[model samples]
Target: MKHLTILVPDAQTSLNTFACIIGAYDIFTRANQHWVGQGKDPVFTVCLAGVSENAVIQQDIMSIRPEFRLSQVAGTNLILIPAISLDFERPEGGNIELTGWIREQYNKGAEVASMCSGGLMLASTGLLDGKSCSIHWNAVDKLKNLFPRVLVKTERLITDAEGIYTNGGGYSFLNLVLYLVEKYYNRETAIYCSKIYQIEIDRQNQSAFTIFTGQKAHGDEVIRKAQAFIEDHFREKISVQDLSTRFAVGRRNFDRRFIKATGNTPVEYVQRVKVESAKKSLESTRKTISEVMYEVGYADVKAFREVFRRITGMSPLEYKNKYNKEGADLAAMS
Candidate 1:
């Protein structure tokens, strides 16, 4: 049997982490049971490994038991790190032991997968340096700020490179586990699990659900002003040159500061702001796609559609149909 070690963080406690740990274990164990029901042998031997023997959470209201500690396990075929506490600013304290074990496992040819913010812990191992990862969209900026070498993408729901894998926000870990189910077991088995769990299979991107709130916590005063200007005048044709002139900063320096502070270039930031505004209008108002696009300062049909799809992974109409109540009702009828 292939060994699957699900690594639970010792001190970290959160509902998402709890769900991921139990969710992963349930799916893997159920996959084995499904195999046995089909008169076939089990494929995986799953273990819950952690730094401590037990972890208490929710003010000691709940506790988790682990099957093995770091020192007890020699090696394993795979490591699944669940989401941890959202305290992204948690200083590098005693967790060197956990991150070090993760790196050592990867070096020994074990594949590692992190769920949601679990990517933060995996990133501590320096294994994510020069690698692409997907984390919760809300935490993308923070993760990028903390680990500059890691390429964090909010568009994708899952990312897999080398021996490392990651997923986007919340309970999307279910989709990632389903992906592994297809990889290790078979497409049919994964479909079976999908049916049983009521999870939509083959979801590749989280962009459709994104709500863009530009990063404003950076200390760059000029860039913050530029961002505010962009938000205020998104309905107008506000160019970068216009912003530079209005802010009395050099064009090149302004661009550098904007990107550094917001993780998006001036033009990209403007487009995102406009799209975000358009999203709100589409959701709450009965504006047609053209009206929404025009209100957001885009006159060209093709240009608006391209930018919307690039950032959101869907056309304006698709987004509207998904989010707007009337559109959803129409879709349900047809």
Candidate 2:
């Protein structure tokens, strides 16, 4: 049987963290039960392991006591890290011992997976260094700033590189668990759990859910000015050459500085700003996709659709149908 340890973090955590822990345990255990019901032996030995005997969460609203402390588990086949509160300034959240233990387990040939913001803890262990990791979109900028060595894939729902798995924000972690279930057990078992939990299987991207708030925390006055200008005039046909000239900087020099400060090229920043504005219009107004596109300064329908899909993983019409209740109702009526 594969030994699967769900880590109960030794830090103040959100209700989301509690849900991930309980949810993972319930799903994996149920997978075993399902196998047993089929007259087959259990596939996993699941346990809740922790650095401390009990960890209080969410201002002591609840406490979790692990089945075994980290010290007690000399080794395991798999270690799952649940989401904990992420202080971007201190991504580790003072869980030094926990990170160390995780690194040790991983070095001992155990697979590690982190759910949502739990990628912060997993990244802290240095296991994700030079590896692709999926994290909550909200934390992408912070993760990039803190762990420059780690390749952060904000659009991906799940990233599996060398046995270290990570998933995107919130309840999307359920999808990652389903993926592991399929890998560790069988596709049939994963499908059974997915049905029981009502989780959509094979969800590959979280880009549709991301709200692109441009990164502006850097210490570059010129770049900040450029960003504000783009945001303020996203509806205008703003070109990089125009921006560079207006800012009194050479084109190549401006491009280098913009990318260094904002992690986006000048053209990408302009596209993101325009797309973000288009998204809001589609969500709140009774505008057609073409109207929204034109309002955001895109005259070409095909080009607008391409950029929208590239950034959001959904077409403008699809995004509207998903987020605009009135639009969805109108479509249903039609």
Highest lDDT: which candidate?
2
Question: Each model's RMSD to truth, in Å?
Answer: 1.7, 1.5
Candidate 2: residue 159 Cα off by (Å): 0.5
lDDT of 2 at 260: 90
TM-score of candidate 1 to 2 decimals: 0.95
Model 1 residue 157 CA deviation (Å) reads: 1.1
lDDT per residue for candidate 1 within 223-315, as digits (tens), equals 888888888889999989989999999999989989999989999999999999988988888889999999999999999999999998999
For model 1 the local lDDT of residue 291 reads: 97
Error in Å for residue 257 of model 2: 1.1
Candidate 1 residue 28 Cα shift, in angstroms, is 0.9
Candidate 1 scores a C-alpha RMSD against the true structure in Å of 1.7
Model 2, span 1-334: residue lDDT tens? 7789998877747777898999999999999999999999898899998776655444457667788878888879999999877663544443677888888888889999999999988888889999999999988887899889999998999999898999998999999999999998899999999999999999999998888888998999998999999999988988899999999999999999999999999899989888888988999999998888889999999999999999999999889999999999989999
**How many clashing pairs does model 1 include?**
0
RMSD of 2: 1.5
Cα displacement (angstroms), candidate 2, residue 68, comes to 1.1
Clashing pairs in 1: none
Separately for all candidates shown, the number of backbone clashes (residues 3 or more apart, or on different chains) is 0, 0
Q: For model 1, what is the alpha-carbon lDDT of residue 190?
A: 96
